[model samples]
Target: MSPRNDIQNIKVREERKRQIMNVALEIIAENGFANASVARIAQRAKISKGLMYNYFESKEDLIINIMLDGFNQLTLSFDTNKDGVLTEEELHYFIDSSFETLKNNIHFWRMYFMVLLQPQVYEIITPYLEKTLQPFYETAINYFIDKGYEDPIAEMRFFAAMMDGVGLHFILDPDNFPLDGVKKKMHRMFK
Candidate 1:
């Protein structure tokens, strides 16, 4: 094929892959991961099952890839300072940006939590999960240590738990949650 034709073909293929993943995200978000069958995803994407397979090896692969994408999105949203430390200003930025991301991609976050609740799904994405979270985890621990806090590890865990609680409340009641108030309170806690 000509170079131009090759480029066009590549674009088409990427678009098709994105379409399939998008449908898969919606299906899994609306229904549990177990309900998100390959056939169902293909049907939702209006593509053949065989064609979907051409893009993804299996339903597990799709879910893992989607979770990885969500992790990437999260890292992109949170800005860490140049020194690789979570300064007070950076902490507020992280909180605000993360809340913004949750607001914008509420469905994806729902799907993420759904997958997280499934024990089996954990095995599939654990490596990626640890790698993705390591930086933030280390940063929090280091920040606490730098602040001369006793039991820095425990402090970091408390910080993580606090963020988890915020996420849980936001996810459970996105429409009614006092997100700004919560953000301010979180800032104070970390500050």
Candidate 2:
């Protein structure tokens, strides 16, 4: 058989990268970023340590990628229209899907929050987090402005704080967390 073409090569590369990332996320989530070394991640991923570097420059790069992946997943439903504006329907959808994502990916979010709680890890990820989340932050603020809130920034802050609180509460106590009730209340309040 002929060797893999460029398209095939790209596909293989992406798949391998994804496999490595998925494994890293789980290991970091389970082991915490401080302890989840690149060698450990590579071992968990069943890939050679040298091969892991071929995909990511270093352990920091690997975790940054994983963190961004979770952040992207969290914001996947935001501004669905791609118009750079959050509509009413989009707000409701974001509220709805945010809960859905939390419910569906608790372990990942748990790790995401765990990483945030680590001061050193948070410091390492802060710059990237700010850069990665700036667009969504602006869009969310714009959303409040369009809604004609008296203090758009404050409103946005309140909404964000509440949402984060809900997510954290659910993560801490998924079994007893009134997920549906909170979702409905959010929809009502934001409605």
Candidate 3:
């Protein structure tokens, strides 16, 4: 096949895969993953279950892909322009962007939390989670270093842990969690 034809074929494949993922997310959101069967997803996607198998090896594969895609979307929302400097405004932008991404995808976050509750799914997802989150961790630490922090890695890790803990709390009880205060606290960090 010509290069142009190869490109077109790849695009078509990616579109189909994206469609499949959308349907999977919808089904998983409506019915928990344990109950969201491949058959149901195929029906929802208006495709054959066998066709889904062409793109994904199994249900677990589909779920992992969904989770990875979510993280990618979140990561992309951050500035990510590390030019050896990070202004307070840029830090605030990162924090707000991160919070907004999570808030916008509450259903996806719920699905992730549910999956984490399952030992089997948790085990399968652990490696992928680590791989996806490592870059964010590195970027955050680098941002701190650029801001003249002496021990950027240590500070970043501490802040990362705090963010994770607070995020989970907000996810569980948004009304009581005061997520709005996060932006203020983040501002204080820079000040």
Candidate 4:
């Protein structure tokens, strides 16, 4: 094939893969991941069942791709100061940005939380989750260390656990819960 033809073929393949992923996301959102089948996803994407195997190895691979994409988007949305230090304002911005993203993609977020609730699914995605979270953890620890805070690692881990717990609470009961009060509570922890 000519170079131009090769480029066109690559573009077509990418578009097809994206279509599959989008359909998978929709199917998994509508039905739980445990109920989402490759055949169902292919049917939803209007593609042959065999064709999905060309793009993804299996349903687990597809689900992981969706999660990895979500994490990448989350990391991109995070805004830190240019000096690699997070100010109080930047920390608040990060929390709000994270909450808004989770809210906007509630389907994916729900799927993620559901997966975590199951040990099998959690095992499948734990490596990916760890890889995705490592940077944030490292940054938080380093930020405290640079500030001359003692036991930076422990402090950062506590902060991370608190943040994760608060996020889960908000996700479960956003109507009755006031997530905006989290920053105040966190501030009080330091005082």
Could you say which candidate leads in lDDT? 2
Please give each candidate's TM-score: 0.83, 0.91, 0.73, 0.74
**Residue pairs whose backbone atoms clash in candidate 3:** none
Residue pairs in collision within model 4: none
How well is each residue in 1-191 modelled by candidate 3, as lDDT tens digits? Answer: 54668888899899999999878877766677788899999988889999999999999999899778866775674555755344566667777887887688766676556555566666777899998888777777887888788999998888777766766776787667778887678668766
**Each candidate: what lDDT?**
0.81, 0.87, 0.77, 0.75
Give one digit per residue, the lDDT tens place, for model 1 in 121-161: 77778987888888877887888898899898899888778
Of the two candidates 1 and 4, the one with more favorable lDDT, higher being better, is: 1
What would you estimate as the lDDT of candidate 3?
A: 0.77
Evaluate model 2: give its TM-score: 0.91
- What is the TM-score of candidate 3? 0.73
Q: What residue pairs clash in candidate 1, if any at all?
A: none
What is the clash count for each candidate, in the order shown? 0, 0, 0, 0
| Poorest lDDT segment (10 consecutive residues) of candidate 4 | 76-85
Badly placed stretches (over 4 Å) of model 1 are: 1-14, 79-83
> Which prediction has more favorable lDDT, 3 or 4?
3
Put the candidates in lDDT order, highest first.
2, 1, 3, 4
Distance from true position, residue 26, model 2, in Å? 2.8
